[model samples]
Target chain A: MSFSHVAIIGLGLLGGSIGLAVRAELPGTKTTGYDADPDVRARARERGLADTVLDDPAEAVRGADLVILCVPVGAMGEAARAIEPGLSADTVISDVGSSKRSITDALVAALPNHQIIPAHPVAGTENSGPDAGFATLFHQRWCIVTPPAGADAEKVASLVDFWESLGALVETMDAEHHDLVLAVTSHIPHLIAYTIVGTASDLEDVTRSEVIKYSAGGFRDFTRIAASDPTMWRDVFLNNKDAVLEMLDRFLTDLALMREAIRAGDGEMMHDTFSRTRAIRRSIVALGQDDPRPDFGRADHE
Target chain B: MSFSHVAIIGLGLLGGSIGLAVRAELPGTKTTGYDADPDVRARARERGLADTVLDDPAEAVRGADLVILCVPVGAMGEAARAIEPGLSADTVISDVGSSKRSITDALVAALPNHQIIPAHPVAGTENSGPDAGFATLFHQRWCIVTPPAGADAEKVASLVDFWESLGALVETMDAEHHDLVLAVTSHIPHLIAYTIVGTASDLEDVTRSEVIKYSAGGFRDFTRIAASDPTMWRDVFLNNKDAVLEMLDRFLTDLALMREAIRAGDGEMMHDTFSRTRAIRRSIVALGQDDPRPDFGRADHE
Candidate 1:
């Protein structure tokens, strides 16, 4: 029950990467792609992002057995609707949205008769658009599948196998829990990064050039996350509002406590929390989520 | 005016790197190193971190024309006091503390009769200790030197020349201004990173494994910064209390506004801030403060 013909409805970073990865790792499968922007479509064609790059979503999905919506979360419903005229009755529908709950609801509302499975391949660089993706984008990364209740087991299994074939490790979880996990892991971190970078840029006392010059000490890391596509992140915050707000509350509580500790000059409390946080980083590196070499091994780039 | 024999008290990342960088870049100068922990001293000796790795701080400083304290900010005074017995009267004293004001005061108070200049080379990785140092650690990085008002120009110029010889681009700034700039650039970013990583780890609903598994979305970057040496960061926040608190207040204010924007579903505000922040990352890359490659160019390791 493997997917032989796949239609990617957005030829951006994730979509284009999927096309490239399928070609690189799952060479037997065929990929068709379409983008709303003609410029992106032309660029995707130039880069051979898909086997057949089409001008319309309906045209792209005509003979495909699977369709993956790779647009922003806020556009999931419209994108799902666009392919409805050409989607086969048995075609498995899925999307790569950062927030699963809203996208799941949107997809179901748009295509109630289709088999919709929402998945988030937790991988990317700060760059975006067609040129930002590479064949190895999903390598060694996690792809969380949030299949709705009563989804066909065979279809879901095939989808899992499809992602695994592209070098991603797959895990299945409920949409609500997926939303909560990602809100903690992705949404709130991005929001906090954007906020801090904004704060640094707006300071009257410290010039922006100084911040840029001295960024290697720490601030540069935050800027990378903050430089993500503004539209995608804006939709993420809007779509996953509940879980994001909940996580933000927890972050604020912890930040206030730290502020108090610093204000009181409580070195012990600061050290305790800072020391406790080291274990998670070690676990992340040990589990292969990140590079173990110093400075993410960038020192050797030259 | 140049330092012929240099003594580095505290053979951790910065001290060890200074020794290695001096050996690589300034072959004529001799470096003597000491660490408080005997285990670190042993490792430094095996690594040949200095020309002579002494077991005692007092022994390390004998007949040295320049002695640099590279201990944590809180330990600067005691490290200075330890070398008092062996310090030559003409030797120039300096330190590599992140926060300049408090370290400058501590060094001056501990060695009132010596020429004291405080410096901060804005460079490091999350990993610390003697094993983390490399000869190119300070290559193309900024070294901020803060000299007191009455300090000799010859001594200050020589200190600048020394840092330049070690591959750092040197800049002179007042101690208080140095604290303010670093509070915005380095200290506050580390505090926010520690706070966010702690917030994610302590969530009762989200298991730690889940957070670690899906960290690639953005949280992993924060964890790296948060994983930095706790004792050094604790002292940094404590020593630069006023500037850090001021910067934290600004960050909190901006964060609250972002929270309000998210709560209100104001996509435009979120987009505007997120988009504006990209310029800083570009400038940092343009200035060579960070690697411009995607994901810090870490993908090649596997």
Candidate 2:
């Protein structure tokens, strides 16, 4: 059973995109949107981000069959609590948070009686806000649905069907495993990007201008990742702390080995490491998970 | 004086791009190319990578007024020595090596009497080989020229003019400084990417399939960088050891601080670090060094 009425809390990139995607892909589905910030609600109304833009979260969720909270992970509990007054007994509660386990726990605690199934669309741009979202953001992207233990199979199927209708491939996993997987894939990459950009910015010998000017040499890619929404990433790292820290330590250990190889001039080891990675990239391109064109088919190169 | 005939010693991505760029942007400039591997030389000939693709490196450089060695950094000396017998007394020696100091020293030692000036074009896709190059690869990209101490100014100016003719913005600097700047901008970024890709691949808990499937979360960008030519990257690390290690240490230090912040749940610190990075991305976009479109304007999203 697909959701006919979807309510999105927090009208940022993810929320706005879901609204737009629903409008484009499932024209019959009604989307109601709300944000804590009044300015965002005003902007959401102007952009036609939903069928109805409400100032109050509870008002927005009223009459919705599915309520998807799109706020940062740290705010999931508060957002879940905000909509409790408006939630119907049959409405399925879910969130678009990077880390699923913590969000699942928070949502369960906040709405003890509601059906909670958290999911993360493994897609986004470096931009944020209502203006940064578009209909095709989820097209051909992976959306991992992390259901709590013994989650109602019907509700889980409904949520998966809803996402599939919006052009996302859905994968169901336990909340614990989802957090561990996304911790390596998303959280740690962001941490590394944020760190490198920070290091580049705080350099004493290399001027910031030089870093910016010669960025095409590879530094620009990190800048793009590092330019992601600060609040969202901050919360992702904080809430996904255990898994992120674990993945980060593994990455650091690998990096230390690389550093030693560099210091010792172990060219063969470096070459082998560099060469084996191309197969994974090839596989990703083959699977349509990434742009097959070189440099991601960036317009500047063309 | 503009180069009437330009000799490219390695017909790989950089070399082939130079040939094609010269053909497109400087129609009058003739290009002669050679690769040590017979297969690459044959492919370069078939692709019209240069006006003339020669079997012998010496034959390739004969009569050319400028010779650009585009081989891996470690092979620069051998490539320089190969063309020494055919180089005109007036031919200016340059290279497209990532590390300027090492390349400059190698070229000077190989052709002691010839004018050696190393320049690095901060441009490329995550691709290699003769077929991977295109005419506009250097358009609007920065070409940093690091001339040896007491190098003839006219030859340097001529080299700058040649690069400018190919639509590159040229900057002159000393070799040592160029190595330091590129360490942060290019070498270390590649190292981090290679290490992260390796780490993700070697993970026992997170299957390689999972890593590839969920790469769009952030890991795909690093995979692209890590998929870069292994031989070239290996040479970059070995040749620019001091500066790359220095920058890597700084990055590690910054990453440690971020790790601690995450462990301590310092949202403010993470937010502050993440926020400041956007400005650099903005500057890069403003300067047209990177694609301003979200996700580098990847076609997969559109």
- Best candidate according to lDDT: 1
* CA lDDT scores, all candidates in order: 0.92, 0.91
Candidate 1 lDDT over A1-302, as tens digits, reads 99999999998889999999999998899999999999999999999999999988899999899999999999999999899999999999998999998999999999999999889999988989999878888888999999999999999999999999989999999999999999989998899889989999999889998999898889999999899999999999999999999999989998899999999999999999999999999999999999988888885323
Clashing pairs in 2: none
What DockQ number belongs to candidate 1? 0.78
lDDT by residue (B148-258, candidate 2, tens digit) is 888889989999999998899999888889999999999888998988888989899989988988999999999888889999999999999999999999998888999
* Tens digits of lDDT, candidate 2, A1-302: 78989999988899999999999999999999999999888899999989999988899999999999999989999988889999999899988889887888899999999888889999999999988889999988999998888788999999999889889998988877888888878788888898899999999889999999999999999998999999999989888889998999999889999999988989899999999988989999999988888899988777
On residues B1-302, what C-alpha lDDT tens digit does candidate 1 reach at each position?
A: 89999999988889989999999999999999999999999999999899998878899999899999999999999999999999988899998999998988888999999999888999888989989899898889999999998998998999999999988999899999999999988999899899989998898899999999999999999998899999999999999999999999999899899999999999999999999999999998988888888878785323
Winning model by DockQ: 2
Q: Which ten residues in a row have the lowest lDDT in candidate 2 chain A?
A: A175-184
TM-score per candidate: 0.99, 0.99
